[model samples]
Target: MGSLGSRIQGSSRGAEEASEGSCAGTGHGCDCRKRKRSSPCQCDSEAEEEDSLLNTPRRKKLKSTSKYIYQTLFLNGENSDIQICALGQEWNLHKVYLCQSGYFSSMFSGSWKESSMTTIELEIPDQNIDTEALQVAFGSLYRDDVLIKPSRVISILAAACMLQLDGLIQQCGETMKETISVKTVCSYYSSAGMYGLDSVTKKCLEWLLNNLMTHQNVELMKELGVAVMEQLVQSSDLFVMQVEMDVYTALKKWMFLQLCPSWNGPIKQLLNDADSWICKRRTELGEEEAFLSTEQGAPFTPVFRQVRLQYIINDLASARILERDNILPHDWLSAVYKLQWFAMLRTEHDNDTGPQEANKEEFDLNSMRCGRKLAKDGDYCWRWTGFNFGFDLLVTYTNRFIVFKRNTLSQPCGGSVSLQPRRHIAYRLRLASFDSSGKLVCSRSTGYQLLTLEKDQEYVVMNLDSRLLAFPLYVCCNFLYTSPASGRRADAPEPESSAHSVS
Candidate 1:
């Protein structure tokens, strides 16, 4: 029985070896089968064991595959009792990695874990903290169609900077700059200065100063105007100072002209001094000054004259008031007319005479009506009728149905007529065939009545058939008659009358 059992075991081992050799693609001389029976199977068994271990669970494979390591930061000295539970009820604490603090010593943290989940929690001491509520607040801030206040933007910027959120910091900075006004910019300057954010402070200051210079005005600049000026002066910011100083000088000149016209000499002197100071300062700082200079080599003569004329007009207008009911003084009228002439001359170079000379002729022609002979050197001869009767002296270039009238004092001339160059007719004159008298009369024409003049009064009338003719008059001193054959229809409506005197 013992021999039979040994034979059977040997037979079984041989059968196993034969099967292994066949599997190795060798009948009986395979090296795997020739190796020691124990070790030969042990190698295959160890490899199978490893394969089974690899296929056992995917969690171990994932752990071995992932090589990323996250760094953690504890902000605000780590005394913060940051509650992990506040992140979310579903937050798994096993995967948490990174954290940071809020700006105001408040506890805030962010964590990342497996399954592609991230959790953020904020802890404010002495306050009821709700993660959803905090999220809603931030969501409202970033939501479209929400009008976010500038203050809120500033707060967000501060918080984003503290959290090391570079993209959020940049976004908030741009928004703050866009909505910040000069007043708010000033306030922000103070706040940013206190925060040791030198870069942010500098950028904000630049924007504020630029905006202030753009809209530089007395009323607007009055708030912190002195401070702004001092800063520009001390910093030697020539461009900013130039803009501000130009606006300041213009406003000063305007106010002075409006408020003190009688003190012309003093005002002019002050303006010159200020202008000189600006020029000198500009030259010292290597900047170009734009102002009128009496010195040599100045290139802006026209601009200087324009500015001077403007000042003169402003002064004159400020000093005088036009009263619709009160009569203007003769001297004041002459002065105003003179100023107007000067303004015209400055604006237009077509006139050869000065404003005073032009105004003298205009005033004399308007004051009284009289005829003057054309001299050999004169350009044109002027013939006018004297002022008399309720109907003043009206003159026209030629005879037309329409008549020109002027306002005059009442007269006693009922029949007497005055002619140019001292010819006075006591009887009314009439028009007959355009002749000097009734010599070439074609037919008898009806004539209008004329007013009789007293000894010192003057009346004008046309003489034809020795009848006086009067018609409605217009106030235009200079008139051009339009002929009926020249497409001028008498039946057409007249133009609207103007209030200005004609000259």
Candidate 2:
């Protein structure tokens, strides 16, 4: 009834020793074997035969002993020698298993009075340690596989870190990484940072930058530290697919959430006085320095500095930001707008292959290299402000090309590229930019195929051919109905929609 060897033996030997507990030693009983007689009923041989059976193999003995130790430590908790108090509950643990930990080893190994006591009480005086986490952590020292729930994972990680259980710490880290997501990553990051879980921290930080803390998922951005938020703004690698203002808008919302609880005034008024709002900090910043203090804009100044005002923020967003008075002042806003204009120019110059001589005759996109200046339909904001000049050029197949001065807007910092609604249905489009003197600047087209427009659907097309489209830019989409599927003439142009200049 012990191991595989004990359960299955010589059939005749099993039958002989099957009478509750009998003797079977080398086919000869111990006493009779010494007397050179085959007597089966020698009662003294039971102890010798049992010892021979149980202690034959070193590995089996070790495995058996290990199992016994585990059972004695965990299964027989009532007989435990130590009472560990955690989270208002006392746990029974064996002194041997407890000694395996440096924390408990230091307590029980010394000549301390508690070491020799019959009922030693153990406690870790950490207010933040989770009791449930401690229980699970202790259970792991006995059982190889322990279930760490998401709700308790952070707590368990903190406890394991405090106890200096390296293996359990590693397991808890893997559990955290496995469960890392938008919903749980913030807590995981907090716990990892709090407990110095470096591997988990690195992974979670990567996740925060790549997938979680973005315009599409702004909620996670609130969980970020000011340092991390600043790093995000400073990083050229940080990619948010939406317009830059969406990113700013998210910060605005987070700012509001920090202040709305205390003030009894209008939200507009609060936004106007955002620097005056006070908020609480989640954790200690470190020695002597408070996490949050009573000061104007102390909580949010770090946030505002990293807003990347150089990105294209549209008129609406600019107005909203100016109205809030939390982020930018009038003079600063105007300066930022000018700065953004120069930044866009620099980006455009960098993106250009070469300042090619103004060529209106060369219209083939494939013949030229991929860049904003060459590729058709590439991401270029329709700079209505600077796009006041351009003339229409007539093309083939009953079609015409309305090439605006400057084929497309330079790199965008803000706003959607939606044309003002007017009375017109577009059939075909060829959006391009030309210089002030009616010279072609850059061009993007649907490439030989006329595209129909749909309402509210972002018909964004990036040429695998045009690599410059990788950067986020607004492409001008005109309204037109062309039904080639209905056998209607694709070139039949509808009424053109009236639009004003917007960038």
Candidate 3:
């Protein structure tokens, strides 16, 4: 039994690795998947180890001579014992392969009525379970290991679930994880959700969130159902390429695609009762093709509700985004600004002057402490970056979107410090950590030059590799301008693990 298990394992891997050879002989090019490999050698190296060679030339010759598709003989039925049918196709499967799965073991064992039957008909009539995938599964039981490919993963998953094939399920999950990318994300997410695979679903969601900026296709966004969209938007841990405004625009584009099919393909007569007030107004201004589309728009409101509109500082861009074809109600942004004002006022009163209508710009860090002073290590600096516990900031591998939520951090410095550059150089900051071998590694940014420390400002890190540093790192920023004679190392606190995996 042990040697058989090892041989089956080796064969499964060998079959997957020999993709070109596998297709050359039998199977692959699933009608249910992306179809034929661009190159069979295009398979990833993560698949499996090489099979051990037979000890003697005699054994090798025998193995090669016997390399017939013996399973096909069962389908051909010289004297087949069992008839298994699925999706209008019949397979003459041997009991050994079929019995390996719990779903089949229960059925074919003496305890079940199927023990008395030779014909087994699967009830998965709703899904197109690829016969090719089933062939691989059964073939593994005989002489090959399971061959899992990303293109055929969804079909394989559906078939495996119904067959209760645990090995196929695991291989599908691992392959999905290894192969996830911009193009396959949506399809993979759908498949993972359909099969109730939580681990794969989590990886998909995280990858999607961190890489959302890569895929901005309206059709792709539309394909993502409301539940998935909401899940992406609702997470604070979502790593985006820009501010929430980019996220907002992406969401609006999706809603537009859903509400206005004409946005993509071609214009059509708008339903008279559709958001007609907005449409008729658009028509009067020679903007007949432009207006708010409310079709299926209700489900998307929660996504916009989660957008931090107040955090988007570019008033003009925000206005243009909100006014594009009048797709969103004009009053929506009005209400948003009002809420921003209300929240700011409430927080301001709670923090200091006890609730008075002050201009939003009045709260700028520049207004506090006259704002143009150098960031010194004295009482003026709020430790480093003026953030408490550093929860309001994160840096990614690209350093293109280093999110430092100014307002989200505790205001230890009370108001903004000088973020603009002095001459040509920008304000700089550094974070450091002891490596696994106890060496200090540092990540610094000089990109804050010519920038204002506004509550809703966006900043990018200038360094590439520095941002990819490990977690449990510490932040350090101090100026030791004491008279050179005052010889003493600047006292610094240890960095807490932010776990900001830079890569």
Highest TM-score: give the candidate number.
Answer: 3
The residue ranges of model 1 lying beyond 4 angstroms of the native Cα positions read: 1-151, 161-167, 217-229, 238-503
The models' CA-based lDDT, in order, is 0.34, 0.48, 0.50
lDDT of 2 by residue, 142-241 (tens): 7666777877777777788777787888888988887777777778777788888899888776555544222233335446666666665444333333
lDDT of 3 by residue, 105-199 (tens): 88887677778789988767536477887766655555545667778888888777777888878888888887776667778888888888888
Candidate 3: list runs displaced more than 4 Å.
1-80, 260-296, 313-339, 346-503
What total of clashing residue pairs does each candidate reach?
13, 17, 9
**Residue 185 error for model 2, in Å?**
1.9
| Residue 186 in candidate 3, Cα distance off native in Å | 1.5
Q: Root-mean-square deviation of each candidate, in angstroms? A: 32.6, 20.0, 21.5
Off-target runs (Cα >4 Å) in candidate 2 are: 1-72, 78-81, 86-88, 108-118, 212-228, 261-298, 313-326, 334-503
State how far residue 238 of model 1 sits from its true place (Å).
Answer: 4.5
lDDT of 3 at 177: 80
Worst 10 residues of 3 by lDDT: 365-374
Error of model 1, residue 94, in angstroms? 12
